[model samples]
Target: MAAIMENVTFIDSSTCAILISAFKAMQLKKTGRLVLADSPVVQSLIELTRLHTVFEILPNQKSGIIGIDGRVKFAITIIGPVN
Candidate 1:
């Protein structure tokens, strides 16, 4: 899926929805990384984890190194189905 960190904001219901969709589409069931622009203790992040149990949350500092559209809060790299 895709996420935007921008200058502020991270993890919302919509973001969670996107992740859920991605998981269903890609069949994610193993350990994965949730790259965040800031911290993973945000409300949305907490909610996301509570709803889904597939990815591990980690802080991302290489957002600048990656070319993204709009702003990004968090990003995930799922090569294939986790299961």
Candidate 2:
């Protein structure tokens, strides 16, 4: 599974923790690359948690999809803040 976090300017510690948990969970069941699109906050959090080695960090969603499927396809789900 791949997650592309965009326009996320701010993220609290608790939320970061939750994200880490979810990423880890996904990692366990992942068949392909577990990619995370670049976001300064998210990248910092991942580095802080030492999960950088666990996930494949990509520059954008398109790259992430390519990294996963080796081509661009419409096979993605975008989940964002409720507000």
Candidate 3:
């Protein structure tokens, strides 16, 4: 998961669903920290997974952050345009 996430900070539609499914599968085990931009794609994924608490939606564009934490074992970033 780290290798997959390490390659990109921005997420386009092509990979969004795949990554979201990966996170959804991990929801039960709490295997990672998901940093999601509050965009339509993310909102849809959240609903699909019904795993709202597992995702940390960026509160503001300026303060958004995405980083890896070994303790969590995985990390994902859902990037969006500045609002």
Model 3 lDDT per residue over 5-67, tens place:
343345455564665666666665556534534345545555456544444443433343334
Local accuracy by lDDT, each model: 0.47, 0.51, 0.44
For residue 81, model 3's alpha carbon misses the true position, in angstroms, by 24
| After superposition, candidate 1 runs with Cα above 4 Å error | 1-4, 28-35, 39-44, 47-52, 61-80
State how far residue 17 of model 1 sits from its true place (Å): 0.8
| Top candidate (lDDT) | 2
Q: Please write out the lDDT profile of model 1 over residues 6-54, one tens digit for every residue.
A: 4544446776676667666655455443434433445356454675245
lDDT comparing candidate 3 with the true structure: 0.44
lDDT of 2 by residue, 1-83 (tens): 55555556787678557656765565565534343444577677766776555544444444434335443322222222222
**Which residue pairs in model 2 clash with each other?**
none
Q: Which stretches in model 3 have alpha-carbon errors above 4 Å?
A: 5-12, 33-83
TM-score of each predicted structure versus truth:
0.41, 0.47, 0.30
